[model samples]
Target: MSSHVYVAFDLGAESGRAVAGIYDGQKLELKTLHRFPNTPLRLPDALTWNVLRQYAEILQGIALAV
Candidate 1:
């Protein structure tokens, strides 16, 4: 039998998370690898999300999945 791993990123209204899915011949399993608050960055003129931070966290999650 062979198995494969897949990573998924979930960004919601209040939070973000990285999840891993493992599949073999039959069933699939999901596991949360990392999570972070989806707080926006307040700028002088506008509000923005911390995209770089999210990317870095996603990499961390992928490492965990590996």
Candidate 2:
């Protein structure tokens, strides 16, 4: 028998998460690998996503998944 792996990213307005799924022919199992806040930065005049931080979180999530 062989197994398969899958990853999913759920990015919402205020938060984000990474999940992993493993399947073996009939059933699937899921696990939450990482979660981080998708907070916006309050700049001098406007709000914006902290993109660098979000990128780092994504990397961390990938690491966890691996």
lDDT on C-alpha atoms for all candidate structures: 0.87, 0.91
Best by lDDT: 2
How many clashing residue pairs are found in candidate 2?
A: 0
In candidate 1, clashing pairs total 0
Backbone collisions counted per model: 0, 0
lDDT of 2 by residue, 1-66 (tens): 798888888888899999999899999999899999999989999999998988899889888877
TM-score per prediction, in order, is 0.90, 0.85
In the order shown, what is each candidate's alpha-carbon RMSD? 1.0, 1.2
Whole-model lDDT, model 2: 0.91
Candidate 2 off by > 4 Å:
none
* Cα lDDT for residue 53, candidate 1: 76
